[model samples]
Target: MKKASLYGTGALLFLALTGCAQQSKSDAAAQLNDQSVMALNWFQQSGEYQALTYQAFTTATYAFDKAQSLTGKPKAVIVDLDETMIDNSAYSAWQVKANKPFEDKSWSRWTHAEQANAVPGAVSFAQYVDSHGGIMFYVSNRDQKDYAATLANLQRLGFPNVNAKTLRLSTTTSNKQARFDAIKNEGYNVVLYVGDNLNDFGAATYHKSNAERRNFVNSNHSLFGTQFIVLPNPLYGDWESGLAPGYNKLTPEQKLKVRADALKAWDGK
Candidate 1:
């Protein structure tokens, strides 16, 4: 009887340990899933917006530093307002929550709709630039028709010293070179160009492959940290385009395959 009781107790202990181990694994998986959901939610919501505002602060300081170094003094820091100076989180969230993909038509409608708010630190930075006699030019890719709403949004956000004419959109020009040229023609030494997209610098030249993009950055690494401050926008950008060009071209299975292949490459086995 003693031997039987001892064996039974041992069996019970083993079962309990096994159950505990399974519970622990289940708990770990649940935690991982929760974290992933939160991360996705952040990207869909305010992550980029928050990043842009912080980048704006960095850009302001960097440009100010460059201006301080110049001989005759740098004149202006050209800024792109959409992703660079405004928080478009609500719109992003709306899209994700509604299961709507990011399409240009939808994006254009969003841009024209005037729903984006001023990014954190953007208003303060712009005000600082104005106070320091630094000209702020809004060289955005937003359509010309969006000028009115864009201006109104900026004004509503209390961005100081902004004239309606200072905001420019692509009409005749295919790229930002023309706008940069215009600034140069106006006889103001442009100290910096702040934006979240590659096109904001010079669209035609910068929107190629990953190698070309990296080369561009390498060629201008000196200016990157100081003059050309980049704001983060992981949810949408050239990077996403590089990863998955036009979702219409790829079926769900194809996308999964591409993602799997990418992971395999990372695994090196």
Candidate 2:
């Protein structure tokens, strides 16, 4: 084994004397919760995802009615890509089957294949706005390299306005304020913003803890189904990322313990 010593000390020999051993794992990915399985199953097989998606559009229609009254420029509806417009549960399902967590290589392969299905209401809603002369903009975090496949996937799934100008991808920051601002600057009246993550709507949702995020959501309760139509994506989200103890730096065991610690529940004797 190559030596790894910290603080200019021969810590390898010191650790050997102290009976400390290096950690080893058979697989690069860690075992995840059954919740991951359940979430994917729910998204794929259940009527709940359909109900929620349709509900978002039902509210969006109401928002559209309000948007029509305000006259200035053409209307636009901003939506997220992954779980909001296109269903990625197939990717999650593959992960569960392979017993692996999210890996960029695997995700990129899926994106490259460009066969993702549409979310329940996404196709019809996009068509609805398109027929009415309102444009649809997909503001996603997909890298620029994936644009071709992403565009192909959207077109294959029949999402309207699948083009360079409409697909605003993240190049620098995950914060979507600049994209939103750009749409506004183009003289499009952004009627409704649809996404699974809070960051898709505005800046207030970034880097917040679970409690803080919930509080922020509560503060904007009035916008729930109106100006903001959020789709459900329980398989993965910023919510999981916002959990305590610097999750990215944690070991598998450490991460499991953190998840266990963060759970809120009732104790029954």
Whole-model lDDT values for every prediction: 0.69, 0.83
Runs of candidate 2 exceeding 4 Å displacement:
1-30
lDDT of 2: 0.83
Q: Which tens-of-lDDT digit does each residue in 158-250 have in candidate 1?
A: 887667658887787547888888887887778778877776777644447555777777887877757777766654556544454463366
Total residue pair clashes for candidate 2? 0
Clashing pairs in model 1? none
| Candidate 2 lDDT tens digits, 1-269 | 34434533666567765653232231323356444877877888888779988998878877876776457688999999999999888888888787777778899999998879998878988999899878999999988888899999999999888898999888899899999999999999898999999988898978788888999889999988888989998988888878873776776666667778887879976
RMSD of each: 12.6, 5.2
**Candidate 1 Cα RMSD (Å):** 12.6
What residue runs in model 1 are displaced by over 4 Å at the alpha carbon?
1-40, 43-52, 68-74, 244-265
Top candidate, metric lDDT = 2
